[model samples]
Target chain A: MITVNNLTKKYSGTTVLNIDSLEIPKGQSFGLVGNNGAGKTTFFSLLLDLIRPTTGAIENNQIKVSESEAWKPYTAAFIDESFLIGYLTPEEYFYFIGELRGQNKADVDSFLAPFEDFFNGEILGGKKYLRDLSKGNQKKAGIVASFIGNPEVIILDEPFANLDPTTQIRLKRLIKELADGNDVTILISSHDLMHVTEVCERVVVLDKGEMVKDIQTSTETLQELETYFTR
Target chain B: MLKQFISLQWKSFFRSASLSSNLFFKILTIFFALYLIAMFTLLGGGIYFILEEKVQKDPLLIINQFLIFYLFIDLVFKYMMQKMPVVNIKPLLYLPFSKSKIVHFSLWKTILSFFNFIHYFFFIPFAVVLIIEGYPPGHVIGWTMGALALIYCNNFINVFLNDVDAVFYSFLGALVILFGLHYYQIFDVTVYTAPIFDALFNQPYLVIIPILLMISMYILAFRYFKNILYLDGGLQQKQQEAKTESFDWLNRFGGISVFLKNDLKLIKRNKRSRTAVIMSLVFIFYGMLFFTGAVEAYEGPVWRIFAGLFVTGGFLFTFGQYVPSWDSSYYQLMMSQNIMYRDYLNAKWWLIVIATILTTLVASFYAYFGLEVYLAILVAAIYNVGVNSHMVLWGGAYVKTPIDLTSNKKAFGDKQAFNVKTLLLTIPKLLLPMALYAVGHYTIGPMLGYALVTLAGLLGFAFKEKVFDIIEKVYKTEKYKTIAAYKQKN
Candidate 1:
């Protein structure tokens, strides 16, 4: 569903990302694991067309991401707090995103019905603006907003980092359900090995902006990943 | 330790990210500050001559009588415009430094504030003139020292009162009552103003009263601030519950209306935007100042056109030019969504239109001045809604600066790029109505001039969609550059 050809990103005079070629087929739950400065965000930014690549291109459904606005209708991403409008309340934010995606307010309200436990009763109807929310709660709101549009392609960067253990478990289940027997392409980057192994069917390891290992999930996939990192 | 703190502050000013990111803006700000200082200094030096020529009285006695009024005005300005001295108190709090030392440092910092020295600009020259006029140097120095002391007294009092709830309104109320009583001759404030300062100049010992008052006020302000400096006490009191409001009627405009609703909330909740709205409202009275016999005697369209456009389009000029940058905090989110850029631009356009109409209606009260004033304002309002609205939106396309919504500072500062091109665009918008009115008045008739101005406005309104489309195209072309600019935290 997504193709990257000779994708490279340079800042100042230094190249930060240089992927020769890569592809994620339709309906795949792909995982990206990397250390600090691994160019994970740069890769996602390129795919979202938030930043232009220095060389080559990213294509979504055979349409060049930079050349057209077609991918934006189906793709939803929650990479950071920048993706959330800080002034609006969570409910107002959802309704706005819903309206943008051609969904009515009532439709959004109904879509949010299942995530009440996921939200922990702290987000909606809380008289505070999104800016005033705690960082973890802000992350929750952004993640929930990404899901409201029923997007075909989902991208989340470090979604598990700020969430508490209970919410993290709930999020893993949510991801599993979305990926199960569905043509929903999910791209997630996480530092936590256990969660990535549990949720993602295939994992790609990146070191210094280059893909090092592309491994299918097996019983020993977690052990192999752990050994590689420690070395 | 205090010297160390001062050096740290100097470093912080020069090394701030805002300075590094926009060096041009920083230099421009310094030049502006220097210009203001020079102007005030010149005003100070010329005050003695101005009083000698204009009032034709003992300039010293005249200045003494006006001294109380000056202090009152100075206090009001300080309360409104002065920012509290800020230091990185957080790092110092955990260190071995005593809390009293820190509080004293802060208080000492206020003594050197620019507001305090502004008074010296007027008083220093006045003092020198008094000495030259054969008054005892000792007495003149005493009165000048007394005046400076009172200025510091007001500065400290302002710091004490600003934290108290309802103080601004109370201070304004007190001023109004004092003015009203004096105006109607119910109370003669000058009766006291003249004698008290006359005694201070004659009896140098009377200066002790102001010095004592200054010390007491400083003590009071220091205790108040020190008490609140503790971490637990530093927490703001729980704010009043925010009422959830819905403008359900706006739903008729669909997605574009959602943006409008957000913009309304933005103005209501954010300090920077709220100040802009209040400033626009305050300017509604600007017509009263201009629509006088002076303007009537001048006899041209120049002043009338200025007063008219300002009265009608003040809010649009102040607030609308910021446009998309007002949403810069969440602009990336908006760009990535399935939203149309046209809807965003239209929302801003509608806001400017509504503001112009409202300001024009308020300024319509200037009809009390003359029928000509009323007619001119109506013509200007139509022109603003029709033509200036689009020009302001076009201006928005170039504003790359992002405003911090929560800053308490009244001035948004030189962060906004005010280039020659912007000035050129603004000059024509302001002048075109006058030109059209003049041509029509000279050739046809006065009434036809008003009609001609209105016709031009109507024509511009008729072609608004085409103008909006062109603005949208410009916005689309500059989208990436704008997004990148907004992403910079500085």
Candidate 2:
């Protein structure tokens, strides 16, 4: 339920991302993949309106993100450590975000109950702030907090990068469960081809901000992605 | 609820990384806060009697006559000492909460600043005095409220000015011109502003005039913040074309040059260090406060030496004490390198020396205070570069607090890379120099005083090799400890 039209972002005359047109239907699981300078983060940032677009607009649901802030209620994103306030405890952060989304502390506590196993009992009931947590635990907290407020759209950038192996596996299961016949729109960018392919039904490959491939995942999709990378 | 924002802010402040790290610092900060409140109360309470004794006129009329001047200076002090509450807005930007509410929350929190409360500490006591002195209670209350409204109006104006540099500069330029006109008797602004405050005291209800102005300024700041609340929105981002500049001129100095260049870059790029450098430079003119005054208390030898030491050595004391901790972000990388410890220490030493020299040279106008004062400044500068600079570096070994170069929380002392031990250590450093000067002046005359201080500096310079060796050993032992502290990011 996102439409990007004539989107281009340039830095000092160097065009980093120049998407002509792209659209994701409601309830779609979308994955983006690109190498370091391929503008995967840039595109996600533009979608989140974290940075202004050089030209054109992004429509979330039916409202233009730049023109109005109405779409913010249904949208949530965990782009990086900057998305987490460093001073707040994990539970406090969750409650803060939940409060912003019209949920009380009880609602947030209930929302967090299902992620106890995912947190491995390390994040909650702890005196340490989110900033003091290990990178993997920090990522877990950020990812779980995005799930609060029952958001319709969630954006995560490099979500699988710093996670430990067990957490990564659990996250994959979590994503698959959320996307299974769910109306939630999940958009994630990752360098891990296998995880993205398994979790996301449709994967888009970008090269230097240009959309190079949009493939529907299948039995052969893994081999095709491998070939594309090796080539 | 709107109250959640305040509670979250409270959590952010008390749970701040540094505040929780040391119990001593927390107590000291609270003590300092209470001390300031007590001082303000005394000043505000005493003003009524002081005015009564100085000029047989009514204190209210006297205050009203200078109210505009007071507000103008208050505006400058407010801008310098106060900061809008810093909220990490990225996480909050996309939340469902309205942008205006976030702006309003920040504005509401700004009212909690120590600067704002300090006004109440001043005004409330003075208002009590006014009522006790048989002034109409209603009129005194109205005058106090009116004055407070204008104070808050100044706060909002300062906020708006702080946001945009062009606006701030123009605002300052206008104020300077107005002040200059009054200073030279070219204009009498007191003739106009005195009546505005007079009306507030007379009618009691005319406080509404400033109340309206306060609301307008509040709305002005609110609209400005609301407009910029969108992520990546504010002013148009200017992305300059990237080009690498070479420091080849520094290449001739060998490995020391490399360290020097890095230190320079650290000061240039980091927010906290850069601000320190600017403040140290600004402090060089501190002599203006002590030397230019006509008051006899300021003419004492103690004040002269204190001001002289500050005029020359301020940079060495402030910036030198944090040399090692300034590189806290990359202390591990530095220790891991094959670079000699002497080079690291010498590079920092040289930077401090150069900074002291630069500050002293820029402040040479202190010569106008006469040759005696100029000689004291020269002696102090030499003492600074020699003895004080080395002491500061030695003090750095004891300072294990890691500064967050990225987040400039407040301008002074909050993230300063020194602990209470070194802070206490500075008292001896300050007093020893002053005592030496005072001893020489009182016992043997000013020339002997200069010679004594200058000789002490030369003595320190003569054996710097020993000093550097001792400091290097201290730093070597503390390097890993410092790295661990720096790794714990705030």
Candidate 3:
């Protein structure tokens, strides 16, 4: 479960994020959609306590995000490649993330096994560092590592951006399976309306840092998003 | 557990080794060249001993002094390459590892560096010569091992001291006290030189001092290692107090504020980038070690100009060359943004320019230990603003193998130097500046002629937009070449 109340953030006198009273029940998948500079990343940063909100608070699973240590064990996020230490090999990075969550190298390598075909051996290969990988592969590595511990909550930013279309479909399916099977709360921000529609139970739309819409995907069709963007 | 840590270290080491492997032959060639030079020095010293009735006053003290000064500069230079710091520290923190083990591993890593090989080449040969010429084996062994241990111990101490919160001022205060003592003729060896060198040359017991000092330094290094581990967290992240007016200087050149803000934000967001700036100042103490010789060498007009040039241009040339590429993987965010490339270039240029001007002024005063180097400083500043600016700016644009600012290891030559184009680019930038100096010296009387040429360069830099336009055209046309060049391992 997650609750955000009056979550506002600003940069240089410009309001990059302004939200008012949004809630998501446990085990639900929520998607964030908007044009560039929509404050999606800012909102994620605030919830993660990576950055402080100007005037707001977020509660994840009944624990205040800014003040609680409970948030650490319950949440994992990959907001960007900045979150990944590029000097590390993919396996080393995964083991590092896993160990932080009290898992061993066996668990990390096992988790990495499912992606061998998808990663094309590039992710775990010895010849290159994570930095030397293509953007898509690096995202795959970051995303898998973020999900490695199976935290109760996951937040991913622009997960589909560098991914190939086939991988995008696979990721959407994976996100849905993760939310439904593991009973996890997942929040994802993206520009792709179709992927968000297919994967999320509800979508929160932001424009210029303010929440413009919060609607269940079952209530609003994909055509409505096209109209919204064009308008 | 130590074995496991060593295994992890070997993994890290081989990763670097693989990068180095790309230049294995080149490294071997350089090694051989240095080996031959050492052999020559050994043979020359032997012939000198044979010719003279008595030893031509063992050059050991001069060599030791040079080694100390060299290592000090070498370590400071290593720290300036933004990537070297972050790369060095990252892995050790994650293992079921003690910070002490990690620091020990890092200290071991320091010896493995190519620069540290200088001790083996230069110092060992001299020691061997002394031993062959009938110095007691204990004296030779003790002195050689003691000196090498001290060199590495000093490097470890630098890394340890660097982690302390007030290290910058502590080091500065220490230097000020030492220099004050020197000026007051307190620490000067003239009073103690006879006894000290006498003990060093004749008595084997004096070697114990450096050996004990090195052992004590190793213990201190372990304590520093423990301190880093037990500290609350790795690199404390504190909220920056947002300031509105501090970035106003960029408003003069429209949209320059964006890149300025970005650069400032980077300096704030990443502790390592700020370390690059601080690391530049650490050289002040290192410079003081040879202050007298450096000043004495600058007594001539040519060497004076060089001292002024080096004192200022050295910092900029060494540290300023790799600009925003220091951002490494994080660079994509800025590149992806709608920001103009020129504005980004201008912000970095200005940062270097400001650093250069401040350094030139300080170095002038620092160069000759008097105001005498001030005129050379003035001329150097003009050249820096004019001629050197273009060189650095162009060098920055073409620079592909940007080291990760967060990584603390010096970029492996095999990683960054595989491309022949890097050589091509460096040749013109290095040669043109020297050619200009030579022409100025020959055409005009040294001081005024160089000053006038520098003035002309400054005028050219005043029209930097024109220079940038040319650079931009090349950057655009060579985008594919640049990408291809950078695509290699480096």
- Scored by DockQ, the top model is 1
lDDT (Cα, tens digit) per residue for candidate 1, span B134-174: 88999999999999999999988877665552685577677
Residue-level lDDT tens digits of model 3 in B157-214: 6665454436745654665565467577678533444355345546667777877777
Q: TM-score for the first chain of model 1? A: 0.98
Model 1: how far residue B328 lies from native, Å: 2.8
Which model scores highest in lDDT? Answer: 1
Q: Is candidate 1 or candidate 3 better by TM-score?
A: 1
| Rank list by TM-score | 1, 2, 3
Highest TM-score scorer: 1
| TM-score pick, better of 2 and 3 | 2
Considering DockQ, which of the candidate structures 1 and 2 is the better prediction for this target?
Answer: 1
Between candidates 1 and 3, which one is better according to DockQ?
1
Candidate 3 ranges beyond 4 A from true positions: A1-195, A198-231, B1-111, B114-116, B132-134, B176-186, B189-220, B223-246, B265-272, B275-300, B311-315, B357-375, B402-431, B455-459, B473-490
**Model 1 lDDT, residue B433, Cα:** 84
| lDDT of model number 2 | 0.77
lDDT for residue B98 in candidate 1, whole number 0-100: 89
Distance (Å) between predicted and true CA of A134, model 1?
2.1
Candidate 2 residue B317 C-alpha distance from true site, Å: 4.0
Model 2 chain A lDDT-worst window of ten: A80-89
